[model samples]
Target chain A: MLITKDIKLADVILQNYHLIPIISRFGIKFGFGDKSVGQICTQYHIKTNFFLEIVNAFNDKDYKPYEKLKNMSLSLTVSYLLKSHYYYNKVKLPFIENLIDSLEWEGEDNLKNKNVLKKFFRQYRKEVNEHTANEETEIYPYVLELEQNYNNTGKVSVSFLEKLKTKSIKDYADTHDELNSSLLDLKNIIIKYLYPAENKDITVQILIEIFKLEKDMTDHTELEEKVVIPVAEKIETELKKRY
Target chain B: MAVKFSFLIVEKSYIIRSGLMQIISNFYETGVVNELHNVDTLLKKLSEVNADVLIINAKLIAAVPELILDIRKRFEQLKLVVFAGTRREADEFPGFDLKISVDEPKHLIVEKIQSLINEIKPKKDNNLSENLSEREKDVVKQIALGKTNKEIGEALFISPHTVITHRKNITGKLGIKTVSGLTVYAILNNLIKIEDAV
Candidate 1:
């Protein structure tokens, strides 16, 4: 499918229904009327190219947005990523945790099993929190600084950023830890082993939440890995060449 | 019949080891994975079992610098992957067949391992002569290089429609449509070098 700026947001959503959640996150509503993707995104103050790149990348498995993404602002990409992190940590995680907490587990063994599930979730949440926190506190700041440095100086020395304990963008990527497997383990325990017959409804609810969070996290990481890092590396190469 | 692959993992962290095992189990329908905390047991196990792959942690490799070469000499067919926690660690072990940062998400790691397995044990029936025509192979090489269909047609003195037809035929025969997948196939079949494809 051809994805040009002239296409309406409503049309794009109609073509690829999976993009509804992603586009909706940017606060664009349905019934966009006659507004094109370019217009709506500009109205919402979203970077049109970045939005198109992301949407197209999501829609087409073969689409590689890295080259087009280099011309786009890193700050916009970083901000979008930061917002996703916020949604995951602040909104989705707590909602799931609350669901788990509200479920009734009868008898001592069931209570024990519930506690185990809770403990596993807590551990997983802690890992995710730390991971996102690291990106927010360390990686994103470093990337922003690199961008600013390059913009202000017109040329940045690798050693200058290294002095601030910020190496290349690749270094930040290297430090990333695999997000925990406890979520899967938690799902397995509940589905295959722990949940009693009567608690099927709650179990289904919890699984749905978990599945949503997993997909969000996967998409978030893919953006960072495939789009953000490559763009950053390109910037780094450009800066190095200038120096 | 599927080839049953066995993995020997040498990681210091029990959590990571178990996590890797869980991911492997989920990814592969038939495989055996044995984990060891240190280098000595890994060596002992290597002697007894013909593991298809050795996934050693970079930290352990650092502690025993000779382990990689030692294993290479003994098990010439075994694929070596250095599972690194950091890029620095990964950089240190450049000699390994692959250096995967443990930082990569689980699905990516599984995908990487699966591709590696396919590389090691390529399907006999999918050989280029039997499946892909010579013309289709040429189209695949161009596709893998990120060439547009128009560009490919220009190069081959064919119409864009002809290029698309060849692409469809190639995808049909190979059962893979993505350019990345075609690139991998091209690389595996020696149609294009890795550097050129990249």
Candidate 2:
């Protein structure tokens, strides 16, 4: 019963990725990310508020916002890495903000105080988008083949990772590292800017939101390393086999 | 209790999906049809799964002959039906055990399919030549020779597109839709010499 319940929960949890289309719409309201999100949000006619609430909740200072954001960010990172391939347009920086905007709002004032958050958003977005583009253009095709052939062969091979370790994969991983560092720098700025002594309810919410955002960034990177990379490697192996 | 038959549905368009959903809904209420999007998936499912009837989408019937051949060869007992999108397409893939167009009313498909199953019930085995005509066979042979429509047209004295038209006609008749299938047919029928193909 417990395993069944857990499996059901996993199914429900995975369904959240389906809502990326909806969450992406908030990018228009906040001008969060790049043109890619804007284009998709418009085409899909995704509702913004529902996604914004999720983003705000992830970044909320009260409750278990940090842990929640980490879980959410990992889900989102995987979803974006997977879903971006379906689109012809490349996923770029503001897309993350678009994703974040749907999950939690750190409040405008918090963003203003920790201006590094803006810089991080800007830099991280650039780096992440570039990384995503590599995956989309080169890596994703291999992954799709793996998915298509999954029924025939139940194993993932390491040759895909070996392929990734070549120049193309290293370039992507380098960009990921750069973006991750920007996020850490942004976290430091937010910590320095947080003045709990002079805070109000809005300030408290902002701090909680920032904390969640920081935790999420870290979690997102780890998941990409652990799950996404391995999946990509499996895909690479499948691709090599096909070629 | 006349025997109830199972059909596999394959298509990409929403219109086709909705129409199929409606027709199957009317007949059985429990939608047993599988809407396949690509050849690989369809082939895998067809080999692994069992069905009493095969209702192929027109687009798929036009796109993958190897898949059709494979299915027909393997599942000889299953009645093969073509749910073509247009009357022209219906005429193209000529001798399906039962042929119905997507534009046909739900009742029309239901009725035709029902009657087809009853008529061919015991001998559900599908033969590749059921749909091909003598002329269509000639066209496929010419195509396997790697003749351009113009060359084939010059030889057959038909327009290039007409050669194309005949080729399409041949594919429909043989239930072998792909160029590769036509190539294979050309080789098998000794229409094109193997050295010429090589």
Candidate 3:
């Protein structure tokens, strides 16, 4: 089912609870008695269309709105990405790490393996922190500047356009492939390699959370690669021709 | 028959690159295609993509003559294809696993790629059961009992190499990679007691 602006926010949550965290990233609070998605977005002063596209992308695996996505502004997209970084570092990573710490190992070998997993996850968290930090300090600023320049200039000179190749997003951002794979490796290690406490439910929960994070991270990267980069590249090409 | 293969194409010309992609995708039920326009990115891309077949333009190979040999050394499983527009251009890169003349009929081009895959594919057993075989179950029991590979080999009266192969097959079949994970599986399956696992 395609999520639309007029759909009741309450009903949307009832249909897919996975979108709750995604919606929260938009600075939306609960207690929506019976408001529509558009009304809630208007309350929060969020762009309702962008919010719908993001939540829809997160909710449905097959929903890729490339044409609509390319039309999104860097400021809006980057703001959403920054909030996702906050969610991961503040809410998701810490929660997973706490769950991992709470897990009880049955044997010495299992304890050793658990230590490895803990170390692996800590390192993975560090990598993600570095990646998002790089994007914030580096990629976002460059794109926002490019966008500002894109708006200002039909008078862009030939020499300035020559310098655009080095400024391409491909050089800086590899689009989170390493981060994605490391997390997948961690998930597989838990599922296939390590055996935790006999109750096993905590391990299952940990796996489920990792799986969800992986999906969310994929959507995040695809938005950058398929949408943002293309738009940025289009701007670069647009700057090449002079008025 | 449902086997899917991944491919990497290195061509500078957009027309040829897109043309090749369209052809391969049209032919296969599923295929992963990665493209690079220049040799500058080839080595980095090759390391990342892990493609089964590399259909590279002959000119790119000519410019970097030792690249094919280097790729062969690193990725022993990778099959090579010379993507030449003319037969004579392809002849310069002789002894390749396959050649794709972009002008070839669509079906013929696909057939050449499929034939290379057939030549490289490992033999499959007809009795490829989804479940672990009796021998594999016995191996899991021995693994849960904390037996080393040599110990398991001695107990099973099989060569250590054969035992290792069985262990790999067991991992593939059960999706349990570690001995401890297999121990849990063994205990759950009644192949071994919980106390034996501990």
Candidate 4:
């Protein structure tokens, strides 16, 4: 179901509790006293439409807000993405890594392969960091500048204009394919090959976390490739003519 | 990797059937042989064993001529090999994947069957639930190195269709649908190294 602005914030939570962490990304706090989504957004200073679109996209996989997202500002998109990165880096990855680190092995064979599994996950964490870091430093800043230059014409910075000469959004978009692949491989390795006997419950918990992370990453990538990149490309085309 | 195929041989003569089974079992170590004197339960046996190759006697198909067409229509993925004892019998048989004659050398029969098995490998066997079979791992390795289905098929000496079959099985077993995800599986499993990926 598409969550709208008038839906109560508590009802939205009841609809999809998974959005609790997602809402937290938007600086929304708990303890809402029977407030609608619009009311909560106003309280939190979040654009209600943007919040709704983001929430609906996460809640329902088929709810692609392509036209709606095109209407959303680039700063809002980038800001939301940055917050997601912060959550992934500071909270999620570390939690998963710690869970993986403490996993207990059963036999000689499983024990032998445990370190390789750990190393593989650690490597994935590293690769994810590299990907997000690249976007954070190189891509997102360029996008924000592209938006700024497009919106505030004749005030385009010289450095930003120079950047426009060499780089394009397609370059970044093309590199989005391998976002959560290693995480997938790690999951396969766990379920298929390197299952732990001791701390089996914790291992299952780790898998649940990994699955959630993969879904979140997939949604994030889909939003970028489908919504953010296309919108920015149009803005880029416009700004290219002026600058 | 060498192919692993379960063979379902439908031949009436006990001597010929046992002889064929012995020859196949000797050289084709991974081949599982099941013999039947009649085609009455062929379809049921095929489904039950999920056999990869079907070796039918031309005489039996000559009696029940529609059996060939029926099997073809139903199990297109099945590798059909005909055992025709004579030139006339061979002529009566359709263009199967392979035709073994009574006079052909045992080595020739083994070679032909081996090549046929190599050309097509079925995916998602029940025994493969715990792990990917060796052939699936090969496909994963090629996939991880960022090769297309055509390229992987050519490299593995299998058809693109067979490659896709393996890919589907790989996805089913590993639950990693993306090529990038399979590539990561390859890397983490040491099927391929990081430097090998493009």
Misplaced by over 4 Å in model 1 are: A14-17, A154-170, A173-177, A233-243, B1-198
Residue pairs in collision within model 1 = none
Query: Of the pair 1 and 4, which is ahead by DockQ?
Result: 4
Every candidate's fraction of true contacts kept comes to 0.00, 0.00, 0.00, 0.28
Give the number of the best model, judged by DockQ.
4
Interface RMSD of each: 17.2, 30.7, 7.6, 4.5
What are the C-alpha RMSDs, in order, of all predicted structures? 24.7, 27.4, 11.5, 16.8
Put the candidates in TM-score order, highest first. 4, 3, 1, 2
Return the TM-score for candidate 1, rounded to 2 decimals.
0.52
Candidate 3 chain A weakest ten by summed lDDT? A108-117
DockQ: the better of candidates 2 and 4: 4
Q: For each candidate, how many residue pairs have backbone atoms clashing (under 3 Å)? A: 0, 13, 0, 0
lDDT of 2 by residue, A1-243 (tens): 111111222232244443333244233233333334324344445432223334343333222223333333233434543543233124433444443333323454334323323333554555555666776666555445444544345554566445444523223453454544454444433343233323345444544544544454454454456555565555445555564
**lDDT, candidate 3, B79-198, per-residue tens:** 889988787778778657887775678788878776776675553322335478899999999998899999999998999999999988876565456565566567556687565664
User: For chain B alone, what TM-score does every candidate structure achieve against the true structure?
Assistant: 0.58, 0.52, 0.64, 0.59
Interface RMSD value for candidate 1, one decimal? 17.2
Off by over 4 Å in 3: A153-166, A173-175, A240-243, B1-198
Worst 10 residues of 1 chain B by lDDT: B122-131
Candidate 4 residue pairs that clash: none
